[model samples]
Target: MTTEQSWWRRNRWPVLALAVLLPGTVILTTSSEWFDYQNGLYSHAVTVPDGQSAVYGGAEFRVDDTVLVRGGTEGGDELELDPDMDLIVAVLEVTPGKDLVDSCNLTISATSPAHPEKRTWNANVDLPRKFPPTGDSQTTCSDSQGEPYRLVVAATVPSGAAETSSWVQIEKIGLTPNYLELELSPSAVSSASTSSDISSSSTSAVRRDDLRQKSNATASRLTRTGSTIRSITNPIG
Candidate 1:
């Protein structure tokens, strides 16, 4: 037999198997990449208006109350806030459809009445030292007590956040690509019109300071020549 013919006869099955499997492996990898790309492109926010409820992740959630608590030094766990930062608390009434409660993350999106720009603040997971307590309520969705319960979430925001219209957003864990935003209505805990008005200058200063501090601590530290050598935190959201 010829040398080429002899080699082909000995390895024909293995060569054919590789030819078939290589394309399938490429397709499998590309299919997952396509799915992730579509999810990133199509993810959107569904706004649940005030006094309304939205069902997500087998749970019905309604924004019961949204309070902008100002001038207090309430802390949670090991986290302490700047005196210029106020607390924006949202109380949600969540009813789980099944026995298992869904886990969710909370965020506060506030738009300044004066500036018309949106700012987002993530909920602090720490239990506050002294907060406007909701009796027997759970701080997270996973800590449900087998029935409808209030879930409290708080974010430390700039001092004059009371002047901004805010919404509480709930992103269900394991069920992604979209999130629910609950509109905050006018609360009985009156807005601090005076504090917000007078503290606007100080609030701007505080925001600049916060940005400077976070840039120094969380953002990548650069060399003297201004090239980043190591990143301290993930910049992607």
Candidate 2:
């Protein structure tokens, strides 16, 4: 082996577990989620560093409106998401160009994707002491209810002394959220496929509502989205 290859082969074992596990987990993450024709996929990427004050950039909601977010907009702002939607992924960037003094303060705010008007989920990144060294802090959303139709993730700095909280000064947020894939019941997607051989007399016996239902289900396409994400952390918890 060449000198470079020989050196790497000898010393690589020290961090080998991390190197192997990292790639396995990443590969597992993609196929773990599915995307279909009826349902749409939505995702975003952001950068918030550890220990540095972050400036929030406004995010556009599916509602066609935009909300502004910055360093001090706390108290957990409310966001409206669309009903009949299924997935939301918030990707954060944790790699800093320079060494960080502390970990990043990552937060997320989410609501039902299927049914709107439901309460939101506000969660934050929990640092495991060896943050920058071990792994990144990300909000990978894995589930959704197709009723609300929107997902909101908010990123913010903790309301404490910069040095006090283990999470502060987020240089970048690496957003990597889970899928909100749909699982349509047979009745929801293929109700008409159930129809069997019938006669003109059967049509006369069928209720008018059944015909109406068939008309509604046939040749149908829907588009639903959620409210604007105000800021990163304030949108969630």
Candidate 3:
């Protein structure tokens, strides 16, 4: 064979192998990078200390405190809890920034390290009231003119579920998913447990009355301020 033919024959197999392997390697590398980018872009989880503030999706989220109530409330009315279930109430303040927040999208969840399961509950944005006056009424996070509004969210979980290492997750629903993971402080859980146990039985009636009065006052104040307390069709998932 000629010198040119000899050179081609010698290099052809290696060149073919390189052409096949290079494309596959590039495709895999590109796919992995794209997957990572998608994960980072679509959802982000931020860990925040209890009683601190964090910003997500252009909204300011502050978890003021958490309370565990032995009883539950519904539609501004108080209700007795099943002996097995207790209410996990979290008080939050959210400041809207140029975007209208669908209050129904705000949700809370509690997860115990001891227990792998997570318990989640929808938020009652119209607070200190438990629920909206009508089915169509909804609470929204609109521009408050530099004022922050209070949002109280309660989830009924099993007694003794609020323990150390337990955490509460707050989700702000929108195109981009963002979550605030707040560690439940041991002191707060212990205090809530002790107080709830005491108030669960002997003082429940008095507590309900007091809560009702507070709800009424809050509703009146919001109404005077032209705050929105309407309900929407967003269901808790």
lDDT of 2 by residue, 10-57 (tens): 788867987998998987776555533212322422333221222222
lDDT of 1 by residue, 147-196 (tens): 88767667777766646577888776555566777777543123333344
lDDT of 3 by residue, 59-170 (tens): 6665544455554323113544555655655445666655555543545556566665766555553222232232211234443455566554555566666554445565
Q: Estimate each model's TM-score.
A: 0.56, 0.17, 0.56
Model 2 lDDT-worst window of ten? 160-169
Better of 1 and 2 by TM-score: 1
lDDT of 2 at 1: 62
- The per-residue C-alpha lDDT of model 2 at residue 200 equals 17
lDDT of each: 0.55, 0.24, 0.49
